[model samples]
Target: MATNVKVIAGDPSQGRTKSSPFEHPYALIPTPSLPTDGSKPHGALLNAVEMFLVHNILIRAINSILYHAPLVKLHDDIKDFLHFCEVFVDFTNLHHDSEEEHIFPEWARACGQPDIMNENVAEHTTFHAGLQELRNYAKQTRDDTTRHSSEEVIRIIDSFAPALTTHLRNEIPTVLQMQQYPNGDEQRKIFAKGVEKGAAQADNTTQIPFALGCHDAGFEGGKHRFPSLPWFVIMGVVWWYGGTHKATWRFCLAICIVGQRRRSFEIVVSEHTRR
Candidate 1:
């Protein structure tokens, strides 16, 4: 698991050639976020945040299948799972990106500690890289027109799941703390950004990357596929990522933006119920 990383001591961007320690077994990133005094997270936000990550990577895993399905080399069942990615991952990515860009800054500014922005940005960058690597690997296989086994997909999953999961475990707690926020300002920013982003999310410019459109045509542009298995699994995954898991993503948006609070209602229901 990734330690609670308040600050990273080492430099990655420096040097003639840029590289990450993710490939190395012994690369150590520090967790200055840990206090000298013992304390524990009540996990008010931790559980939901973790589910958000689960949905994200799992859907991307499915999207990898969708992106490669048309090619002769890919397996059919895997391709079937991609529809989940098409509908879920792109939506959530936009949501998370909006959060990072709009929500986090507001929290940092409100809490009067804008310094945490750098760490969150770095973590976001790392997550995108892991995503690109998986997509690239799948794309190369698609081009080969060579048959792929479940084993190959699992290999890709194995490579990505650890890093992505570690990121979820570590980075989540850092942001969810009450100390990092000032009232509900950050939540307000999230809704404003979500409405703005969500409105445009249906456009070709938004979903084309994960699904079919001008940019992805040769690789995966065609009629939309609807598989209930994928959609249902993806809904669960969505709950895992930024879906129904987070009280804030659901309730705060409702509370801060919609001004809906029945008994100071924080999400009336969460993934716990789904489980």
Candidate 2:
């Protein structure tokens, strides 16, 4: 895989045109003012923040392809960008699936709010369809050597941009609102468990690397805490499984060691660059 990346680095296009979406600038959700000490029912907040981060990354990737369509001539660049798309889709799908199977159901049962997460659940269909379309387009682009224009991919993304953005933006506040449940104590416990279970369910190989690649540890003065994972697995198991792909995630930093009664986990992250 590493060798293939460099082999196709040479491709030429002398006079192609550059074009990007000109309508309006896209805005990402501001990272919420979440508590640092874990006093709050912040499982939802952490999960929502992860979603927001991935959403922003995916949108930016799409925009980058379209924005530099003219300048990007190498097959390797296109392939790498498309690989990023696959990772994005995989992460999004894994997250939503985990929520539907574990997180949402637990939240509903614990909070006695059966319909609280229904809207977010329903919104998945709208974006999932678009995601599938974009994924399919990316696959096609990957397979076809003659293919150059990203206009179709751009159009497909634009077709669902409104609904996708709405779902991404709206769901954060909805999850954040779960902190206000009447049975607050039980709800916090449930959310924490749900987050842990959801993380465990994800494919350790792609899931861990993709997440580490996208997450910015420096954000908010390096004080922001991300959901923690086990030290043994991250350092031992994950490192072995990741293999060649590990180089792509050199940005990861082992920030902290989370010790609980039942288990202990280390936080893998990126270096915090003080701005």
TM-score of each: 0.43, 0.67
Model 1 / residue 67 / CA error / Å: 18
Error of 2 at 127 (Å): 1.6
Q: Tell me the tens digit of each residue's lDDT in model 2 across 16-48.
A: 112212112455456776675866645556656
Among these predicted structures, which one has the highest lDDT? 2
Instruction: Name model 1 segments beyond 4 Å from true.
Output: 1-75, 82-96, 139-145, 179-182, 185-192, 195-199, 202-275
Give per-residue lDDT, candidate 1, residue 127.
58
Q: What is the lDDT of candidate 2?
A: 0.55
- Candidate 1 lDDT tens digits, 159-230: 555655466555555555644444544444453554466446543322322221111101112122221136
lDDT of 2 at 226: 50
